[model samples]
Target: MAKRDLRALMQPAAAGMFMKQFLRWALVCCAGVFLAYTLSALKVNKAPSDPWAAHCLSQFLSDARSFSTATSDLKTTVNDLSAGDTASLTHARQALLRCRLSYKKIEYFMEYFFAYPVNLYNRAPVHEIEEPYMEYQSPVGLQLIEDLLYGEDPFAQKQALQEQAAVVQSTAADIPASVYGFEATGVQVAESLSQELIRVMALGIAGYDAPVCKSGLPESAVALQSVKAVLAAKTAGEQNLYADSCMHYLDKAIVLLQASTGFDTFDRLSLLTDALLPAQEYLNRYCCQQYPGIGGEGAYNYNARHLFRPDALRQAAFDRLAQSDTAAGLVALGKLLFSDNRLSGDNTRSCATCHKPSLYFSDGLKGSPTIGNGGSTRRNAPSLLYSSYQYGQFLDARDASLEKQIYTVLQNPDEMHSRLDDVVRKLDNKTYRPLLRKAFSQAGKQITPAMIARAIAAYERSLSPFNSAFDRYINGDHNAMNVSQRRGFNLFMGKALCGTCHFAPLFNGTLPPLFNRTELEVLGTPDGGSLDKPVPDTDSGRFGIFPIEFYQYAFKTPTVRNAGETAPYMHNGSFTTLEDLIEFYNRGGGAGIGLEVPTQTLSPRKLNLSQAEIADLKSFMLALKDSL
Candidate 1:
């Protein structure tokens, strides 16, 4: 081809390249236009750069912690703020004006809900949400909770259910979860205890005391002496030999319990009703002969519960759980998570450390020490055995339910001083998701404090060790206790007024549902004297919650069962022995004030126990104890 023809071909190729470049530039321009439009839709204009607003937001979070024991100011600020301090709450005042996060607000009130269920049940003061603006007007947080909890709208129901999750999460949110509330060992321990409780309750009536029983002797002195002689034996072998040797003679005892065959002339029913100690002894022997593992199956001891109410629940919840692999899987997964200390920020503790199963799921301490520098609080660490049955918690009766109680302890600086932020981070851990997914059959929305609380609560209810000698005695065991224990029981009910606080069966500080220890009372307890004028732990009692003079120096009343093992009694480990406590009660509690009076009509009159009577009372309390 000629030079002109070659230039023409090259010119066409050059033209195509120019067109391609033009189209590419046009497309780029269109894309930029679309991006600009999208950005504008978000209304991304920066707020009139208010340095004050920015400073306020920063200051608000710095000063306001969402922890339950939050300072009044901080508490006020968080409730009013809608956005997190990092978000729209651009000023301290703004953040302190409106609560934005639904979860945070719900949790804040949930703490109150569990703390005062009856109070809320009767009158849920809707204005509390206005706490941030208590002095002002708009009731934002309170309205939100009220709308959800008591609202009829579909949206409200949905919100209420979702709120439960937040409620559970709220407790441990402050927990770093380095080791499952590692930020606060007490929280971890309480959570651990909660888990144990849930697990125990699932056993259902399996561990509950049956009403059938044993009845042994009418003559209190003879029965008491006989039982004491057996007890005084140096070894388990000796006790057993005496029991077994007497088995032939026990025909009279057995007849006394089951029937009045030989005692036809006596009031057999009355004799049976009066034989607490003899009943305890008979049950103990029977229990030793029947089941092992009572006191570790050693010849050292025999738990009498087996004879009367052995695994007596009419319906075991675990039976339902065991029926399906899914439920079992969930429980197993929960058990693992419950035991995993890795949930802690530092892997230093788990739910099991303080709520060890071996210890009947209670810390073997007068009072659990604080996980932080704040130090431990007053009260003996109550056993977590019948926690599910508890109507109120702590020796001070501060918390109401297991879930809320668990949360309170979680947030307590002396307890679980853990940060919820840390817990969420760990619960959201990528590695654990698969296990959680398999366990719950659904990978839940990252582990929240609410989820942890509920899970632990479910687990804690399972720790009940039902069917003790005392229970058998109540059911039908006449020989469950000696004559002294029987008389003591009589005094406990008729004279001591113990049944008024600690109900039957579980012996927790409640008479079923609405009847609870939520009511405040001042025992006028003698101030535990120290080298210092005012002891460091002088409990102002419920007065700390409200400054009423009448609400002075009062604490919670724990269950009387298991009193033998859980020592160092009272609010601040004040009394060293049960005898001392008895004496304190006999003298009345306000001795220091020269009153030593019981504030309640139920008590306050001195126990007025004579020396012999004190021994009898002690023996009766002894009936409440049993192996875990």
Candidate 2:
């Protein structure tokens, strides 16, 4: 009876087990169906037919058509204008204004790809610098024509105006073909838009472009319209909410520009704070969310909260110099070698002899004295605070690499006067061997001159500091700069021409977008700042090494970062005070003092800065005192 009961219980248990298996299979099938549905939904919602690039191309073509037509009309108007003036000059001005509007439609796009040509066609005539290879140029573009055509002597400038119109027409004709072949990514477009917007806000609204014409207000409206079109094209279809947000801010900016009146009377601060800044902020937000890898460049970055950040630039510079080694070890070994006197011929002096860290890495002397005995060096010992960021080393830019610069200085009779072989032999001795082992490990086992040079280079690369009050102001701390400093900043970027050479952020010669190469200038520095009896300094400069006519009297543009601390300015230490140095630049260097420099790269025209303006500029330079 007991066995039969047990068998009966087993039968019910088997049936329960089958039921459980059936429920498990049914639940799995339902989950698979739900997953498929979710994936299908995502595919439908995320996909858009006309992507950002497609919309951009379509808008570009339309803008090209408008530009071509406008140029043709302007050309006809110019041809009709004569001395008697068959058509009123006012009508011609209207036509010119229309043409500018059409061009503004694709301004940033063209400027980004064909910057060289665009600059040639549209650059202001102020403080134009000549290069070694290029021919001398006068102001020959739209701004020059604007000045002449809208001046008191429009009738007198009829022929010149007509010629300028023809040049502009040809340039406009080339835009379509140039734009069609060019390739660009969405991030690059954003960068160009942001930069051009800055130019538009800072220069355009200030009547810099339409100085004599007083068409800044209208021209700004048209420029804003072009920006609007670009934003519209990029954010064409659904599934781009971030771009839509960008479009909203851009639309508001256009409205602000359209409503603004009086070129000289318009509130520039309002436009900057309200319209431009908001649009820029939104665009930056979109870019960071969409493409985190792509970055905004030197003058501005939508990704960056402020206009300037030196830490990022310094890191970028360091990345280029040291590719393999740990920065910590390399810097440590470099610091040790920097102070060690064993590298010298008599083992009595080292790099620290001239470059003292306490004095902003400068020797505080007019010229670098000899290491062994006391003798004078021809050139001043430039502070090495940020020397590693420069491409060419030394006052003449003779050494292409920092390592080579060390070697050159070491062997120079007036400097360290040590042989590389001798230095390497000394470094391999008991005192330095252990430190080398800690820095380079296996590579340090057999010491060489190159290794020592690299260690020193690494330390030099770590020296540039960008945390200054001016930097803070540009980086979004409005309170950092006082009113005078702000005015000085404007003058620096505008009439002063200091920014034309010592570029912002780095405040050096490293060009933007690709901050790899450096530029040299022939400033025609005088032997003394005495206006009563000025004489041109006779230094062969870069020509000594290159032996080229153009390179004569050319020296590297040094960083103006620590101008407050590093004194006895210029290659020869001619100016003893900052005020005197400013005066020298204000008078347009040696050429302005009646010295003949045939290949003088610096413009030989006085800046004519007022006393207040001079004080303001000085204030700005002082603000660059490194916080670090």
Candidate 3:
């Protein structure tokens, strides 16, 4: 300030300056310490390099590049098809096959990691109606191209084919950016391989994508080879027995698929039982050995040995509520309620009246008699076997779960003709009260509609007894299925295209690997089994529920597991015998029989199955009957 009256002011000013200098030095030191700490933390938190991620990224990029190139070539070839010449058509077809092969090589990763984008690359050829929004997405990608090129007039569809090929090439070009930073762990790679195997079995062999081209067998071989390559990359230099066994089985399967005589003649049963199943078992074991504490994060149970193993799928993953130890008690109570006629309005009919236990839970009638005998029920009663595994229930797939399905049936006027509350009240007597109390002890002496529904659903869920001859055959009893049954199984899975909708293991509408959705198809079933005078069934089926145009007359694909005992097939119960039913499908549903079924999803082309083949198919279905 002032010179402090000479010496005093000078001393005060000098001391203040020294204090300021000390503070500056302290601030600089603190900043230096903070910077060092930040650097140390950054180094500590840095992720370790993942060899699996590196290998997967490399393979994905390589395949993506090949796919992009193939699709570009496909587009050019398809454009040339506008000339409408035989040579142009042949070149286009060959280019399309090459494009498909390239796509299959990378399908596992694309489907596993990027489902939404991949849809544009290989969705079903049909126009898909997105529910709620009702957005109709016209078919695009390889399937549509395959259909167009193989249709009766490929020349007429040249422009459309060219557009689809362009879409596919554009989608392929974006693949690398879409998976730019994807880090694949060993467990995920293993899980992807397992899921790919299911896809190959269910969709690949069944000609799901190559419906017209009949290139499914070769595509499946390429897909399997890609899986083998991934497995080898992961287990490189490892001498584990499980790894060796997995490789051996995969090699055997690849060889078998490559040497296939034709799609219809391929021994699918042997390939499945002897190669795919065994390979899955060994691969699962190897994964467990390598990554002991890791677990899968989807519907599939990565720890399971094979697809047919009881624990292969996490069943609880599909359930709306988590299952508990009380399920056993709930199942017992449900069984009692399922048979009690008192639950019906008139107390004269029960679930067993329609779904009789003696006939594999299906009444041996064209359609079961209505609750009070006015007219027959609209649809035939479907068997309760394996009903719980599906995402939707009933012929129309109107119900999302077994519990909801039971509730609807209890309240339907044409069925039980009773409300859930009425059923609960009827079951409050000594015969059911104690059982209900034990099953739902946490509810504290209250009997509710939900409890009844849960109990009945639990009982239905308990009916999935995978102990049929087919199950035994797949699980290592080579003699369980006879030669006729084996041939039939192959026909059903391969030539018949049954496995695409009625997926294996469960043999129902539920899609596997990711058991997230149930599919419905418009088969255009006739009103009666008269092929000469075929008429489309009046029942609207799934269209009654969703009201989507494409879903007109669509119905859930019922399991053929116990077709032997559950006669009178289809929603209308129009076909009275297995032979007649096979004949109907052989002739190609209603459309093929000259019925006006505009939305018929079933191919109108004849199956041309021999009588012996039909007999074999029946035998295979009969073999699906459980040992109940």
- What lDDT does the true structure give each of the candidates? 0.41, 0.67, 0.78
lDDT of 2 by residue, 538-586 (tens): 8979888777655678889888887888888899888887778878778
Q: Please give, for residues 1-628, the per-residue lDDT of candidate 3 as tens digits.
A: 0000011102455335424533553464356446645655555432215787578768888999999999999999988875558999999999999999999999888888778767677867654565446665545568777777877788877766876787788768766655533456666777788789888877788777776677889999999999989888877886778888988998999999999989988998888888988998898788788777445445677688788877777667777553552554777777878898987898988888898889999998888888776788888999999887777789888887888888888888888899777777778787677777778775457788888888888888788888999988888899999999999999987787767668887887777767777777777788877889987688998788877666888888888889899989998889899999988888877777988776666666687999999999999989998987
Clashing pairs in model 3, backbone N/Cα/C closer than 3 A: 4-9
Model 2 TM-score (2 dp): 0.74
Worst 10 residues of 1 by lDDT: 1-10
Ranking by lDDT: 3, 2, 1
TM-score for every candidate vs. truth?
0.46, 0.74, 0.89
Error of 1 at 189 (Å): 46
Clashes of each: 88, 0, 1
Ranking by TM-score: 3, 2, 1
What TM-score should be assigned to candidate 1? 0.46
TM-score of 3: 0.89
Which of candidates 1 and 3 is the stronger one according to lDDT? 3
lDDT per residue as tens, model 1, 250-278: 34443443443321122322332344324
How close to the true structure is residue 11 of candidate 3, measured as C-alpha lDDT? 44
